[model samples]
Target: MRQPENLIEINYAANQSSVDVDELGMRDMQRRVFAEKDAQYLLVKAPPASGKSRALMFVALDKLFHQGINKIIIAVPERSIGASFASTALVQHGFFADWEIEDRNNLCTPGGDSGKVDAFLRFLEGDDTVLVCTHATLRFAMAKLPASAFDDTLVAIDEFHHVSADKDSSRLGQVVHEIMSGSSAHVVAMTGSYFRGDSVPVLMPEDEEKFTPVTFNYYDQLNGYKHLKSLGIGHHFYQGRYTDAIHEVFDPDLKTLIHIPSVNSSESTKDKIEEVNRILDLIGTFEGKDESGIMRLRTPDGRVLRVADLVDDSDLMARSNLLGYLGQVAAKDKDAVDVIIALGMAKEGFDWPFAEHALTVGHRSSLTEVIQIIGRVTRDAQGKPRAQFTNLIAEPAADADEVTTAVNTMLKAITASLLMEQVLAPNFNFKPKEPGEAPEPGTLAVKGLKAPPTDRVRQIIETDLNDLKATILQDPGFRRAAAGQLDAEVANKVLIPKILRERYPDLNSAEAESLRQHVVVDSVVKAGEVKEVGDKKFVMLAKKYVDLDKLDINLIDKVNPFQRAFEVLSKSVDPKTLRVVMDAIAETRIEVTAEEAVLMYPKLREFQRMEGRVPSIRSKDPHEKRLAEILLFLRRAKASQAKVNA
Candidate 1:
């Protein structure tokens, strides 16, 4: 039987502030971006379904009519997302102007790139004010037209994380660089997740610094929602085929979207179409396909389910018909589709507002993809008070050669949870405690928390905190540290700063330290508990309760930022399976370096004095065992030197 490991469950206030409209008909996130409508290079980092598309429309219209911009070019990652930037009636909602686009201006319809590019070029030369196209079309158009052709245009890229800083591989990135470098064009970049999977940055440091950022985190979007009050992210572990255990987590009552594993992934059955059929059989008795190709299933309880099958691609015409029907029906009626099972089509920019659950099989290697999939079910809807995301993974077998891979996948899943917790929690404002001064209502005053000393550091801390944490959590060194292979302080002080310097080479030493401290503070604080006791609030720092007034950076540095992940793993997984995971990690433990030996030598002497003998590898304490490993490492090095001398 597969059991769910509900790692993090967050409850929001649901104050209905996010959806509240202002006089200009803008939601919270849109209002924030529209305030900075004058920025030539603006980046909006908000969650999905937070009115980001309309925010772009608001800003693009302002630029086109008032900001001296001649034309607007909105490019999306795919044709499906192009629908987001369609014509709008802003004046009906209290704005000064209305957004209108001719039918021929939207190049996202079924068309070839060559033709779209030609249409794009024609629009650029004509008197039209706005045109929508796919990113590929923009790339193709840029190849033929010089950058000067877009001198007075506003280029807005949706799902902007797809544009990487690597000029060698990403033609869209090259197109952006060319346009910005050779012409005086206003650019807007928007994305749900700012970080990428491969750790390659989305933009160069210099180029990123030029943009003014508007960061509306997940907390703001969810906490201010009118309907969604809570969200839960969990993992379900199955020993054998995932299909055999799908019923354990698949709840037919909840509106759901299921993403089957990719064909190349380890958990995949290698035949997606057959897998879809098998899932349908497991759900209920399959009746037959409807006129629009939707799979109809009759459950044991005598209820019929309308399931959309996107994995079957053998018949293009039938699939097109199914897609067209889904697009039209999903918008108007909540009961039009009961379930949507897709392989790779419905992950990004697929809007299903009534979906209450997003179930995924197999570990998604990309955190961005995971976030996007989670976004599909997070939209606020009537009668939907909660959203849930569950990842179904295969448990490691004792005799399997790929046990290491399985363990890595599990650790990545855990880290992704940790990152999501940071994303979903409310923002913290940590300030230095002053003598006889009272803290603000929602702020924390610490004795030794270092304030950001530079504006550059401050900006990064304010806007790029989650992105910075994402980079750190994905680092190989941090992964080892999270697995208990390295000391906590070393991870906090050494490895973290090294990563920051590499990520932002322009930061001075002081700025880097400040940024590193902010990261540690934010992660540790979010992972711990905060409770109110009478007039004083107490925070749990490394299992000990400390007054919020006395909390300091030194106290925070001693605790591992990832301690909660390990603790959650211990409680979530069975003892035997956890032992398997730990043993697999131990097999590939990092060797003790000389610098680490220097750090551990004092602990080694202290252990000798206390135990009246050398530390033993069989000890129950992890640190004591670590000292023993260091001793063995030194002995081996001495022996190797002796052999060389001989």
Candidate 2:
């Protein structure tokens, strides 16, 4: 078996005149072709709308006429996908211009006109022909082909994962492994889902480290957020049970694509009919008068049909009506809302940019399947940021917890994979950020935080404190204790004092008292209490006051002023004098009635605003401020407004 000469300076543009290099899909294909050239095998993994088929079609032409390498085989998991590719090559890419493509179904060759299997093998060994067939045919041909048959051939496998895991010995995997060991040939395996670490060994032999995995998880590489925003794609996420909450978020202006799995074979046909009626009912309510109100349905039978003109009781005639409606929609209003109600069949290969929302009701546990469903809604296109909304509908019987866990894990994996590729991939060619495009101020400030030796221990304590605060805040009885009204004795005896001691263990009784005095002042000032502490007082004049703002509130809150005099003297302060100041504040309890609670609500809002917290208040009716104001006014206002004049 002789090695074929490398076809250098191949004029891809000259051979394929119809191929548009500037198209997003074509440019993506070119990147894969170059990256894969150095490997013994290459895998192209992409999602539904990522244009995997179109990429393969262009690559096929470049390999055949442009590269002038005659013996090339294009294999697909299903006969339909293969036929579809062949049709596109002939009609769209002009591949059938000067050459005839032979299918495995009918062929007669030098092997004495044997079965279609034998004839296909002989055709591959013969001159200038491209073989397009299914995995079954490819396996059969490979098993019967002579040792010299694949010496210079290139095998392109579509939906390659099916071959690696499917029932029969995957013809593509088997042949590629055999050829790499015995002959010199390049194998390209393409699929939307390429589970790399697990599928690699089966797809390529263990010894063959010459495998390059190229993935275009559209959301990761395409910067879908920025791209979609540029195209005016508005993202709407409705977080609740799908069936109940999804309808509320539906925008009649945008076309919707719904993916719902059929229950079973018997129920699928019935479900399609019901789905058509529902779509018609919704579209009829549209205020605007346009042909855009059309509904197109893609059935399980692989036929894409429309829902217009179908009589309510028509049986098989409904299928034809669907087909007619689809034809009109595809031809005339291509960008119209395409409401697709499908089972899991459309998960991988379907791509419709006009679909702005996807509602999935399918019961699939595979991460790949879930990713594919989400991918359908994230496709990049020109008009209206293709499918900016995704709604997942769970079956009644589904375990909500298990489903959420699985979906979250899958999402994390997608996000991590995207980040890794962006930051680590060698040949990654994303544009460098412009000067103005850099992150906003303080964005990367935390990158300078040097970890302390006790960082982990400190984190645990902080987390515990946060959790405790949340629990306390949520308790109805605890919330009734307005700002200064919380029983300090109970707090001091319980976890609050313990946590404070843990955070400030060095504070002695007198120093702790000074800290508590400051906490009172800070809290009072925050509550709009503008009373001033006299400067001539001993406590206020301690060394003309060491900056009180720098004092630890936790340490201050636990002080016993009578225990030590120099504890205040350690800071050049007189304990007896400071006690008077502290006692004065203590005597003025400033009772925090429910009315005071209401008055203090605005301070909470102001604190939240200053701290950059999410504004939870949406309106004044349910607003915390309003609630506080109403409650306080009722408690403190004049009797005329408060009392009923019965």
Candidate 3:
């Protein structure tokens, strides 16, 4: 593959090389969560590498030694993360005790009982301080033991984002809810990113308020890094397959970990052998093996890269053997393997300290996934002063609406996240989007501020985004509008302004409206819905009018970032059929109080009685729940009012 003429490169300023030293006796965020002595339920919202795992150890140990806790169960999402609780040297780091875990208790190992009910039961009978297992194992324990058996025990859920606050969640969520309701157990919930982009709260507000929150920020972690200087995140689009675009974005000289797209992706041949061959052939064929049996590839740039193929390819034995050697490596040797090519590996909790870049070939599956993949490169390495994450997403040739919508929606989400990251980093300032000069979608640039953000500014932005993202996940009108497809008046005027006012009660109508416009502009531009004119750049909102400046909230054009993307998604679904779905979504967002929703319910049922069916076709949508809640609230309210009158 020849290098494409267009090569997009973006660089960001480095963060400070060191952080403020913490006082002895407590880790960074642990001090707050630990100090909440009156609280039984604790929620720790911290960033990755902020010592959250150790914080859990400290809390769990306190529960056992001081509180009335007999057994402790630590549940993680995956097997690899189980190692987080494995016998760490916490005592040496100024803790009361070491996290002592029996080797046998780590039940996520291969052939071991990942559903380790018997092991949990046995541990309960005896005296085991901590039993580390996967989420699957925790579910099995709940099934085997009586709910009463959980009494006097402390259950800590790590990666707490997986536990949906709503009833629609899986066992991980159901298990925690049951533990809270049915048992007298203490719960400590921890997550690197507490706000799930999916909109389902990990715990309902009523449940969440009971827990004391220990929070950390991105600004804190990055500003205090020991070795890392700066971080860059970029998204590059190609004409066809990502493999062809690899040369356009990937820098072979940088120590990188390449995650080959899944077999389902256009870049993957669905055959591992062919993928490896293509990667090697694109870079350079091996001239020969090195002294230590490392596969040396002389790239087109003429630099030799010690490539380690984690996937089983034509050189199966050699690739497999090199992987074994990497596993035993205690510390990074700068002279070691230069690249790691993996398929379904090296993603979460897999540490390769020397890695300088984490490059991928697709729009990440979820916002959480994008965070985790970027985490792979952000870790500080000895000689590496800066790190980067490159997302080489495939841009299919413009064809029908369905494909285009999927691509654009994905691009929108990716760019929004990237923008958020830079804002939260060391110093960031996003100039209000001026009307005539919008940056083209997928065009790369880094914006930084000279002055650092005050703690107040960081808190406000975080609160605004956290609230906005939650609405994006759950609210039909807002979600659709944010995607820039739903061109409803309420979303632009009523819905968004109302939210901003609520987040900042002090803001007047004018201030709130101005804030709302800037937000909409951010969404529109980042979602890849803008185009360049002769000299001015115009955002493609309604009729495609060139904008003069960023502060004009009331624009001459109708704005829906997803408007174009929605057109693409709409091509697949019949326009008539989509009207039915949209109607249901709007009707369900009933926005009534307990009394109003309840009163609305029987009315809803009567309407259904006349109409012969529920409003929505999708069984799992939130509006379904809202419908029932409204009816119940209305009936109960009337009944109580009758009682009061009597």
Best model per lDDT: 1
**Steric collisions counted per model:** 0, 9, 23
- Tens digit per residue, CA lDDT, model 3, 1-646: 2222211222334343223324435654566566763468877776666677877877888888898888888888888678778887767667778788998777766555633767777888887667888888888778776777889988888888888866766767778878888899998888766656564656654565557666665556656566776777655555555555677666777888888878865546678767776777777768876644567888887888787777765576675466556654512576687788888777766667778888887665556666667677766666888877776655433342345344444445454444444334433234444335555453312232111134333333433353354344334344345344233344555556665654455555555554555455455444433466675555554565544333233552146543433443244334444454344344434344443343345656775797686654343433444455455556677899999999
Highest TM-score: give the candidate number.
Answer: 1
TM-score of 1: 0.96
Query: Following a full C-alpha superposition, what root-mean-square deviation does model 2 have from the true structure?
Result: 22.7
lDDT value for candidate 2?
A: 0.41
Whole-model lDDT, model 1: 0.87
Q: What order do candidates take by lDDT, descending?
A: 1, 3, 2
Q: Supply candidate 2's per-residue lDDT for 438.
A: 44
Residues 1-646, model 2: lDDT tens digits? 1111211111111222122344333454445654455454666765554556666655555566655456777776654355445534334433333334644433222123236576566676577457766666777776776545776667777776565522254556656666667766667777665432221224432422355666654333344233243112211222333334445544455555555445452112345556545554544443232343244445444433432322233554554445344444542464444455554454555545445565554333343454555555555444644344333322211233343333232222222222222111112111112334444332211121222234332322222222222222222222212222233323332323333343344545443333323323222122121233563211221123322222333332333211111121112213442233233323333334443354445655675577575333232221343333334454565565557653
Model 3, position 61: C-alpha lDDT score: 85
TM-score of 3: 0.67
In candidate 1, position 192 carries an lDDT of: 96
